[model samples]
Target: MNRSGKAVIVLLILLAAASISLSGVIYYNLEKEKSQTNNLSVEISDIESEKARLEEKIDEQKTELSKVYARLEQNEKKFKKLTFSIDEEKRKSQEVVSESASLRKDLADTKTAKVDLERKITQNQEELDSFKLEIAQLKKVKDVLQAKLKELTGDFDVELGKIVIGPEDASSKSSPRIDATKKKSAASNLEGKILVVNKEYDFAVINLGARDGVSVGDMLSIYHKGNYVGDIVIERVDEMMSSANFLSSNTKEKVKEGDKVVYRSS
Candidate 1:
């Protein structure tokens, strides 16, 4: 062999070795880049899952807040109702107090009126007692006057014939004759004395009866101490007793027991 041919063979061998080393280095770098890309994609997916969970918790908190607001509104309405009830009770209490005051005033006025009525009753009773005392005093004075008049008059006891009747006659002869006739008529009339007086019936029982010329329908005059008391009409007559009814001219004077009953001149 020649020297120049040997140098060309060595140069071709060196170029082939350099090309193989460059190809191995490029394949190793490409595999390492692919593995890094896969790891990055997995990390991004995990972050998205965590965000969805956080959003769900926020929605639940909002729903709870709405419930709390609703309860607060209901409590406010209850407080308003309680306040109105308290005001109504206070108004009713005021009305009851006013009515009690009015009733007490009326009761006090009624008590005052009752006291005045009692005072009037006492005054009227005292006046009635004073009037009764005055009447008793007047009765005593009248009795004294009646006794004095009786003492001044003379005794009137006499026979029936001696008593004058209506008018006197001028001549003594005519006077005797008239006197005789009057005596006969007077004797025929009823004459008696009161034995008992029945004030309730306004009647009297006489001592004279049919035996003394006394008969029913006979008129008699009752007298007390020569003063005319009343007139009587005979109702019944027996042998010694007669009953007569009194006819009053004055109501104040009453015929009593032991009064004289004389014949009335017709």
Candidate 2:
């Protein structure tokens, strides 16, 4: 019960209270650290799950990318084929244009040739007409010459016949009765041979002449090989030969050289 004894008891009581407070503080700190560690573990597990989901998304994107690349390759092949077809069509078009040009040139040449042919034909026709005109003019001149020659030849043949027949008296030449009698005598038994025949002019020449009683306007019969050929009329007379033109009515055959010529009464 003294002051020292009481102070010692109080001090012991204070120490006991302090030790209890420290033990309580240490237990509370240990419990807080255990709770914090459990929260850290939960956070790590959630982060790992999020990483696995992101990887799966990346794999899906890669598969889609491969399909897109395949489709792009197919489109490129189609483009190449289209380009080739377009080039082929262009070549064919060029060939057609060239052919058209050639055809046009040929057509123009053909037209030119046709025109030239027509011009030549026209020139030839003009020349032919000119030749025909010249022929007609020659025919007219020949007819005039033939008529003049016939008149002169008749007079010469008469004089020659008088001289060869021993000369006629002047009164006998003037007498119509004497002339008629002479003509009647000349009509009998007159025969001769054809010296020449001209089929183009339908005329013949005979050996019989004025001296043989052949005169202009006398009718004669023609014969070949005993067959009657044709009839001819004396056109011109000479001393030794006479020219006669054929008659169309009874000309059964063409007169030939050496054919027989005989006088016939009208």
Predicted model with the maximum TM-score:
2
- For model 2, the local distance difference test gives 0.59
- CA error at residue 48 for candidate 2, angstroms: 99
* Candidate 2: tens digits of C-alpha lDDT, residues 1-266: 99866665555555445445544543453354344445544554554455455445545555554554555455455555545655667665766656545545554554555455455545545554544444444343334334434544554454444432212232233211237567558655877888666554567777776556677998988889888887899999864567888888347246667889888755
Once superposed on the true structure, which residue ranges of model 1 sit more than 4 Å away at CA? Answer: 1-186, 189-191, 249-253
Task: Tell me the alpha-carbon RMSD of every candidate.
Answer: 78.7, 77.4
* lDDT (CA) per prediction: 0.53, 0.59
Lowest-lDDT window of 10 residues in candidate 2?
Answer: 164-173
Instruction: Name the lDDT value of residue 212 in candidate 2.
Output: 64
Count backbone clashes in candidate 2: 0
Best by lDDT: 2
| Candidate 1: residue 162 lDDT (0-100) | 36
Residue by residue across 111-156, what tens digits does model 1's lDDT show? 4544554455455445445444443433332333233233222121
